[model samples]
Target: MIREFDRWAYDNRLRAWRAEWKLIVAFVMLAVVMMGGWREQWLVLIGMAYWIVARARVPFSVYGKAMLAASVFLGLSLLTLVVSVSVPFQITFIDSQLQPAAKLAVRSLAAWSCLFFLLITTPAPDLIAVLRRMRLPAALVELCFLMYRFIFLLEQAAAELMLALRARSGGTHWRHGGMLMYQLWMKTWQSYEAFSRSLAARGGVASAGHTHQREKAHVPLVDVAAGIIMALLLGWAWRKG
Candidate 1:
């Protein structure tokens, strides 16, 4: 999933557009979501969905799967928020929690949709570049990069290990399944070590006595300018509200 996310990010139609505007559009809509009610949130949500699916030309399956992955957490959170009691075999939903939970669910989904659009369209390295251009702290930027790379690396390792197990026809065997976990742990450590070495060789981290160069992309004008303006207006209204 992480690899697919990175793949789409690098290969999406919006990949070449100026990362600045993408961030602007995403953050502005996020502002709208942060302050806007259900109506405003809905607008942002649907608009972002369309931009990602229709305008950006992302495959519907990819988008759905990505959102569905995020939805698992959101669902669990909403479940906990709505369910007041789980002990004594009394898993009861509290009536009083329904409205608040619904509101939270909407807000959370809106926020995730907005952010997901950004993630899908902009590659992680580009985002890190933008953060550096914004003059954010080196430590924070480097940490974010490492965390992002680490997730991708872990996913890659797990996928490879699972594939190996499956190829050997032991993927479903109980003994092999248990060993898979151990293999994955060892693979993760090895992948991390390899990643560290490669990153050091590339001088990926600025703190490692290496000068990290920043390559800026031209923020080309996009057709979404009008949409961005509209979103900013909505953000203004949200401020008043």
Candidate 2:
């Protein structure tokens, strides 16, 4: 996925420019302002603006999914809060409780945006290289690789389970709900058992790669400048806040 984003970014000429540094600075300043108890609605506005400008140069599809996922989660969380509080707290729509929700949302958005930007833009292999360069243990890196591979397998298994359920249940109408759920549980268990058995047969250490060759790439000047500016902005935000 990271490789796909790299290809897309390069294809679209969405490489970093000098103005991106200014946007990063502005985001940091807004984050500080947000920490000073800005109105929830205002904070949300600023947070979104920060995300938009910060992600502007990246391939839209790469970052758009992150934004959409965050929005969905935020909406669901806000809805749950509103429903739970409507009686005791006398809250109405989302706007009535916007301040608290906005506070939570903005902080989450900031942290997620920071991490997502770093991950989507940075090559996965380069990340490993940097970690190795910093003397991280080989065992940990191997664990990371294994975990990444397993996650995709797990996701595929989950999709198959969902499809099987959908085929048998036909939208899980009330008449078939209980039976459908039972079938799903049985199928899920069988899937897990199969996966565990496969893992055990593989000596519980699948994909044991030998002779790892570390690929080398020259770090560009722009990447260095971007890192420095981001670090300074982060430091300033921390101290000023």
Clashing pairs in 2: none
> Which candidate number has the best TM-score?
1
Alpha-carbon lDDT, every model: 0.79, 0.55
Candidates' RMSD to native: 4.1, 7.0
lDDT tens readout by residue for model 1, 55-86: 78899999999778778898987888778675
Clash statistics: count for each candidate: 1, 0
Give the 10-residue window scoring lowest on summed lDDT in candidate 1.
207-216
**TM-scores of all candidate predictions against the true structure:** 0.79, 0.54
lDDT of 2 at 232: 61
TM-score of 1: 0.79
